[model samples]
Target: MRSSRRWRRLCGGRNSMDHTKQLLRISDIAAAAPDVLRYRFTAAEGELAPFLPGQYICLYYEIDGTTTGRPYSIASSPREAEEGGYYDLFIHVGGSFTSRWLGQHGTVGTTIRASHPLGEFCITPETPRKIVGISGGMSVTPLRSMVRSIVDSDTDREISLFCGWDDPAAMLFREEFTALARGCDRVRVRFALAQNPQPEDKHGYFTAEDILRETDAAEAAYYLCGPQAMYDTLHDGLTAGGVRPERYRREVPGELHCPPYPTAPGECYPLTIHTGSGTVTATAAAGESVLVALERAGVSPRAYCRSGSCGYCRSRLLSGEVWTDPDRAPATADGVFHPCCSFPRSALTVVLPE
Candidate 1:
């Protein structure tokens, strides 16, 4: 593990919050799509620490005196981390923090706190030789990193990318991906447009035939990142096409909205929160997850992949009743649950980390 001193040096004039947290200064900002901005953070003094190509970092911010954070994929390649001491991120406008603060008040030289690179969404030693990457909208960020890293390393591994969007203009990294495919024989790229596809593009969403035509879906490793609907469609389509469930991994970008509670009590419950420092009382909404209720009461717990996949916001359900999806809940022997997916059903007492 490398020290975050490099990041701290880059964020000069800012104080480091802790060993795990580092400040990042935005070095450049440019338009990536219609409502998205590609932000670059440059290292001023030392080299930016290296991270796995598809891994992400939690960017934290203080809004109205309360701290909050969101996870975003590092769009730049590991080669950039070594040579340029910088990385890129795509932020869509009109969200909670990214939209509320960065999109509105952020600019070149703006600074913020962030966690060290984290996540297992990257290629591992056990990854198969052939890879098929499927993405839509801003979800293309991580795939971009993997593609760029593979190209930069001059690896012999084969990659096939299928990007989907509403139209040609809505597709991101089109020019870059086109050039990459034209230059590298190991890489192949395809685009699927829901409307008005060009001569060589496919129409509508990606189908099994579309994927099978490019590569052997059953033999290749699959990476998926996109919206819920897109993920469901592609996953089912690929599974039906002989792709094994264990051969594929997915990461859903942006906020993971919880499903509506069919039998919600429809009443708020008193909540007692116990942290390392002390205990605080708040109200947990029956309809919302405990994570949302905590945030609503001005308490921000470290969270990533709000879809309940990442166990960042794991808290002990000391004394309470919560309805959670056993499939999505984290596996733990302790009396703990991921607040992001667990909704309070009655008055509760919970314990959180400092």
Candidate 2:
């Protein structure tokens, strides 16, 4: 491990955060797709920390004086992390501020703040079983980590991966995934092309029917990471096919894009939020997420992975009615909910964590 003094030197003598936050420098960048880039980062002066195969790191960026963070899945296996002293993140050029900033400034030697790995979507080595991974578009980043880990560790566990993209040019990590399949007998890789597929690819979107046809659906531990529509289709199809819920897990890449609430158009509701410091009130426009409402009122709340997969924005729904994206809604217990994916349906009150 590198010393803190070295880290400070590499980071221009900046003070380190007490927690897992680190200042890292981009070491390399490679085009993964037409709109996707693979960014490799290393500790300014020390070895990078190890992370689970399916975990993610939050990257913080300051744009127009507003600091915001976005979570990107770790695309490298744990073994690679230990050996290379770096982390790999595959980012798509989306409409988000962070993605736009990265597209412009993600050059080698650019220093940025990043959180340590955080997420629970990983394989438990002790509970080994046949594994099936399903992913779509850039969401394949974490699944690639899981699959690579399995191959690097020389685990005999049967692994089946189904990855889909809009087309061959849109597919990220195409060569790498194909190489892994060729090297490992227990690993099976399939590609789904949604449009203008080449002769070697499977046409159409990735569906539950593909999983059922390629792998042992009943016995394998299924891991899914993709768009919400994919989740809904797979969840319904798998359940109807008699697969137990416990045998499957899922992770959505970003905040849910829910349809407009059935309220009259242009309607807005009052939203009162009570935090440890004081109470803040704001108006939540129809079809807008409560998180956006809070931001609009200049209320700064700690949040990451705005897609609702991360529990960082969880708060207590003290009063009022809110509708959550069904696919991204966290399990509600004792009135707890993730406001990032919640839409106010009525005048609402919520208690924010300190």
92-210, model 2: which lDDT tens digit per residue? 86656569789997789999988777766766543346888889877889988888877776446668889888867778877888898998887888888989886887898877777
- lDDT (Cα) of model 1: 0.76
RMSD (CA, Å), each prediction: 5.5, 6.2
The number of clashing residue pairs in each candidate reads 0, 2
Once superposed on the true structure, which residue ranges of model 1 sit more than 4 Å away at CA?
1-19, 44-47, 258-267, 286-288, 296-301, 325-327, 330-334
lDDT tens digits by residue: candidate 1, 1-354: 122333233233222323266678899999887878888986544445557768887777677766667788999987687777788988786656546588888788888877777776777545687889999877899999988876876446778999998867667899999999999888899998888998888888887667877788768988988887887677777888888887888884555345455545557899999878788899987777788777766765788666577677888888978887665674565678888878877899988966
* Candidate 1 pairs with clashing backbones: none
Q: Estimate each model's TM-score.
A: 0.86, 0.82
RMSD of 2: 6.2
